[model samples]
Target: MNKKIHLKVNTDLNATGEVLSWFEQINQPPLSDKKIWWQCQTLLIEGFANIVEHAHKNLPLETPIELEVLRLNEYIEIRIWSFGQAFDLQQQLQTKPELTDNFQERGRGLKIMDSIAEELNYLPIDAHRHCLFLKIKY
Candidate 1:
């Protein structure tokens, strides 16, 4: 584990920019491959937005959403912690969208996350908390 960057924000959509800004701060020199950097940033924001829209949707407005980003030798690990009921992320990942499907406003998070992350996982951090973990190799 390298130096970790942690942030705790209220479970609201307004905090997205703050999260993205925090992410950009660490991307100082930028990755050698700009595409990789952009992709990882997209995945990170998508993961955070998913939690806000799906996991913490019904929770209190004050509920905390914690984010931890770690840049290792070859990969970046992102952990998003929220106090929401645990869901089967593997099952969700299996439900891919078909190219012919009609246009819909939502239901693409799992697919987007699956397409980008080298490893996507979900775990319970006790009865009251759940974590969404994403790992992307550069």
Candidate 2:
């Protein structure tokens, strides 16, 4: 059977933990695989951190970010939305910086997410809302 989960949270540092907890709640026995679960969890945290760091960087503390997960028979889709500012994720994807050293502390989130996601796209829900969509096959 197909299932869906929805979460709405502030664009704060705490959102990362909330996202992880939500993921754990949905990752049940028989369906649980460590690698797949970690991939999804990582993507979710990266997406949340991106919005918190970039989109809401100068915005109000109460700004909201929305996350939705849809589970299908063969794959799962995650949609993340924010109303802070418009960002060109596609452009960012194309210009990923080279990671030469393990000590490099920046520019790896997008690349990692891109590698794991089967499909990734950015959609402007409206003039104010921006959405990042990611699909991963199990």
My TM-score estimates for the predictions, one after another, are: 0.92, 0.90
Cα-based lDDT for every prediction: 0.85, 0.80
Could you give me the TM-score of model 1 versus the true structure? Answer: 0.92
* Tens digits of per-residue lDDT for model 2, 6-50: 998887987677788887655654356678877888888887888
Best by TM-score: 1
RMSD to true structure for each model, in Å: 1.7, 1.8
> Can you tell me which runs of candidate 1 are displaced by over 4 Å?
96-102
The worst-scoring run of ten residues by lDDT in candidate 2 lies at: 98-107
Determine which window of 10 residues in candidate 1 has minimal summed lDDT: 94-103
Report the lDDT of model 1 for residue 36: 90
